[model samples]
Target: ATGNYLDDLSAESHVILTNAKAEVEILKAQVGDYLQFIRNGYFCLDSKSWEQGNRVYNRTVTLRDSWAKMKQKMGL
Candidate 1:
């Protein structure tokens, strides 16, 4: 009877440990998903910054072109 009780206790302990391990695995997966989300946000922001820089570059090129045309008309 004592041996049977010990076996029951061991089985219960195994079930508890297995459940804890599963919980930890779930948390790890959540953390991984959060990291990916943060990385995606960073990349999106970087893309916006690049787009703004390109727009500024295009504006500068347009102004330069206009200046050159004005100079040509004045024969300078």
Candidate 2:
């Protein structure tokens, strides 16, 4: 739904919200994994993992915003 749909797009918003929630959960788990991996000293100052975590965090924020929109549409 891209977070800009009109009020009549609740169906699409619901679909987007479902997918976004799933993605958020997965990305959160991935971040947790990265944290554990880093703690194990697999690589110090690992740019790749840090970059991935940042990307996931950003996506999660967008998804959460989208979810908020969906909830508002649904009158929740």
Candidate 3:
């Protein structure tokens, strides 16, 4: 999906999901603060956006889906 498989720019699709809600503490997060979003992934406050007064978060890592992998291995 988001990963590029070829050199063509149209080969990859970019999706932006915005306006998801978060805990109140997220409002107080400073730049470079690391956060674990439940069932989602780890994220960090985007320093550049913070400097611009925007509460932007960049996903650092995706949560591992062991169950999904197991199911795939089993041909489910």
Best by lDDT: 3
Estimated TM-score per prediction? 0.18, 0.18, 0.73
Assess candidate 1 and give its lDDT: 0.31
Give, for candidate 1, the lowest lDDT window spanning 10 residues.
Answer: 54-63
lDDT of each: 0.31, 0.38, 0.80
Query: Candidate 3: where are CA atoms >4 Å away?
Result: 1-15
Stretches of candidate 1 off by over 4 Å are 1-64
The ten-residue window of minimal lDDT in model 2 covers 35-44
Better of 1 and 3 by TM-score: 3
RMSD of 1: 30.4
Q: Considering lDDT, which of the candidate structures 2 and 3 is the better prediction for this target?
A: 3
Clashing pairs in 1: none
How does residue 4 of candidate 2 score in lDDT?
A: 65
lDDT tens digits by residue: candidate 3, 1-76: 5576564555223345587877898898888789998898898998987888887777788899999999999999
